[model samples]
Target chain A: MAGRRVIPGFGLSLGFTLFYLGLLVLLPLAALVVKASSLGFAGFAQVLGSPQVQAALRVSFVSAAIAALGNGLFGLLLAWVLVRYRFIGRRAIDALVDLPFALPTAVAGIALATLYAPQGWIGQWFARADIQIAYTRAGIVVALTFVGLPFVVRTLQPVLLDLDAEVEQAARSLGASRWQTFSRVILPALVPALITGMTLAFARAAGEYGSVVFIAGNMPGQTEIAPLVIMTRLEQFDYAGATAVGAAMLAVSLLLLLAVNLLQAWTRRKLGGA
Target chain B: MAFHRILRSFTALALITAALLTQIAGCSSKDGDTAQPGTSLTLLNVSYDPTRELYKEVNAAFADDYRRKTGIDVRIEQSHGGSGKQARSVIDGLQADVVSLALGYDIDQIAAKASLLPADWQCRLPCNSSPFTSTIVMLVRKGNPRAIRDWGDLTRQGVSVITPNPKTSGGARWNYLAAWAFAQRNGRDPREFLAALYANVAVLDLGARGSTTTFVQRNIGDVLLTWENEAYLALKEFGADRFEVVVPSISVLCETPVAVVDTVAMRHGTRNAAEAYLQFLYTPQAQDIAARHGFRPRDASVAARYADKFAPLVLVGIDSFGGWPQAQARHFAQGGLFDQLYGGR
Candidate 1:
């Protein structure tokens, strides 16, 4: 097997990867599935069909999607700015991009909640207009956006740095306008990375608990997120019901990410072939 | 170079794995030492939030008394969280020798789920096993800008209220029941009153401390529904110039219950110490300490000594609402009054 291998120690590395993945990821997921199955199909259906559960799932998915979309656009602009331009505090800004990753999620939740509460520094202005932010659906989106920002910015930064400026120069030398050059050339080149970043951000936001709970008021059927609902069920000592909700969330997230990855792969292949 | 990179990565992974294994080993070895015969005994007291100060005083006093009496060095470890969360941790094997929680229902959950104590465990101590009691009171901004004086004022349109989620917080359950009791006493429909009052709630925090932070630090709501001790603590900590305590005309007596976990105490062979520790809470000295810390002492003389500190008000007990089990099932359970009030919104 060693003689036939294209790479040396492939067997060892593969074994290590499988062992680590199985121990950390697959085993816990399998346990969750088993726990959920104890509820039976009808019981699972009943858990998902509850109006409060349905409302929480909607809040989680919709707010996560909006946050991911916001990150996609702003994150690309930030990556482009950092890659293509030199500024006074370029190194400082680059380091700051990873702040969300280093900060604890609960701290971020509390900070965000404080900053957006009605009497807070920024919230007082919004309060004047009678538009509430903290303890509302919009507050959940803000916290998710804070935690998910780094995924997009960090993922696109490397890709943006690798992009050749000569391609854009050539487009400019031709008759293509700025919009056409960006849409036809630069955007197509970045689509695969952008989608990857957005998918990661969306998945993270969907499962976020600590940050959202602090700001989300947690009014059932109004601002409660799916993860909080699972926690609430667990607190009620309804383990099977909690796992059933968790399994449903896991299935949906997996399918959605799978679809996004498939799209990214297709785009990559077409561009490479072209 | 590729082989060197792989080797370096594997070395790092091995170091991380070794570190994690050592931590786990350290935890198990510590657990093993509890059963060994020794002159010194350690007990874990799982309690709810807002009782940290009260317990700090009680534990220190108890430790000194125990040392003087039995000459046994007793170390009491304290764990605090939302009462229901604390109870859940006990049920999930937290090895709590005693549970001093914000409400009796939380202790009842542990009784039903983990068999830590029998269902009639509350009968072991006097006053339904509640050493000290508090009541639901209002904390308002200084000068009472909203002029909110009673539960009815909380339902006014422009007044925003702050309280925790009842499902997760034992203190919030008392707040919810207090409002219900007040409404009923006032000849108003309890359900309608609750619905209107909750509508005025700008935020339903996860626990009592979170609600306090929202009301005091963040300054979000016009009024806060919280435990009587918590209100006084906020007033003392934040200064009377910034906050004021309002004793409503009628409120529910928020009894904080203490009980020994028989299974845990027996397992650790610390049953005697655990029972003695709880029994100590009922002493006149401990009751005085409870009163000084803003709780209504159960001991009549100690309570009278601090009567000037607490305002006079009518307090309905949990028995009037058919006890903890029925109240828990009817009011705070899923699809109960709480769910109908907030979920329907």
Candidate 2:
């Protein structure tokens, strides 16, 4: 088999990949699914259908989506700056983008909470305006955005770096405006990478707990997130209910990610075939 | 060629070093597990947060007293976290020789789930095995800017409150019930009062310490609903001049219970030491230590000595709500009263 393939050890490498993924990812998820299945389909639906659980899921998904959209806009601008411009501290800025990935999420949460609490340094300004940030839904979004920023910026950097400036020059030569060049020529090429980055960010933010919990205020059916609801159930020793909610979250996340993937594929086929 | 050979040699050296380290770790852990007859014994006391300081003093004093009396050197180890989380650890087999958790329900969980101890473990010791007790109190900013005097004041609009999530913090459960008791005692609808109280909460942190941070360090809320000891702790930690504790007219009596895990203790052959360690907590010396750490000592004389330290208040015990099991099921459970009340907003 090794001799037959252009790349050696096809069978061995594929086996290793499967084993690694199965051990690290699929095993725990399979256990979660098994535990969740104990609730049966009806019990699972009832658990997720509860008003509190519904509210929590809405908070988690909506905040994660908003955070991901914010990341997509800002992350693209950041990656573009690093790739297309020559500036002092460019390398430092690029390295700084990975800080969120390195810092413990609890630390980021505490820091964010302290910085955004009503009387905090940044929060004081908002307070003067009679606007609350920490202990509100806005606070969860802030924490999620902090955690998911690196995912977007890191994902887009490579693709942005590889994008040729000559393509923009070619569009300019053909009497296209700057916006037209970016929208028609440059943007279509970056769409797939942007979607991938946004999806990764959304997935990360959706599952975030430690950072968001500190700032969430955690009012049920209000600021409460789905992860906190699972934690609450576990605290009550309702393992079956906890896993039921978790399984529902996992299924929904999978569906959303799959849709994004399909959209990415469609964009790739349209552009690649052209 | 020489670089590749050097890298290979280093890789082999790393593997050899890793193997050697694991062998040493295995040997040391094996040695620490067994209790030899006359030399020394080990007991792991799994506890909850806010008792860290109290236990530190108790552990040191008890260790000295045990060595002096029995001449068998006893070392007590400790593991602390959120109450329910610590209980879950014991249930999942953390080998806790004794568990001195924040509430009765947590210990009850160990009995029910793990069978590590008898279901009647609470009756095994005096005072339901709670050597010291605490009550829910309000910690307010200095000068009481909001004019917050009681549980009723907490529900007032424009008065931000800070308390942990009852689902996560044992102390928060007591806080919630304390407010409920106060409302009932005042002849108002308890559920509506609770809903209003939580409506004013600025942050529902996961534990007592986190809520203290929100109230003290971050300065987010107008008041902090917390354990009596925790309120005092915040005053001592952040300077008494910055905050003051208000003993509500009525509050819930927080009974933090302890017990020996029969299975773990018997297996380790440290049952005697574990029982003795808990027994030591009831002594005058340990009770005094508990008082200094801001807990209301169960010892009458010790509590009297510190009576001036704690303000007078009517404290309703867990029995008022049909004990922890019923209270836990009614209030803190999923879609229970806490969820129902807080979810309304």
Q: For each prediction, how big is the interface RMSD? A: 2.7, 2.6
DockQ of prediction 1? 0.48
lDDT of 2 by residue, B1-345 (tens): 544776799999999999999997775454343445457877899999999988888998998888887777888898988999999989988989999999999999999998899999999999999999998999999999898889999988899899999999999999999988998899999999998988888778899988998889888889999888998888888898999888779998889999999998877778888898999999999999999989999999998999899888898999999998899888887778887875531
Indicate the worst ten consecutive residues by lDDT in candidate 1 chain B: B29-38
Off by over 4 Å in 2: A4-8, B1-38
- Give candidate 2's TM-score: 0.93
Give me the displacement of residue A17 in model 2, in angstroms: 2.4
lDDT string for model 1 (A1-274, tens) is 6758777777678898999999999999999999999999999988898888889999999999999999999999999998999989999998998998999999999999889998888888999999889989999999999989999998998888888999999999998999989998899888988998998999999999988889888888889999988987876778898999999999999999889988988998998787
lDDT, candidates in the order shown: 0.90, 0.89
lDDT of model 1 at residue B107? 90
User: What's the TM-score of chain A alone for every prediction?
Assistant: 0.96, 0.96
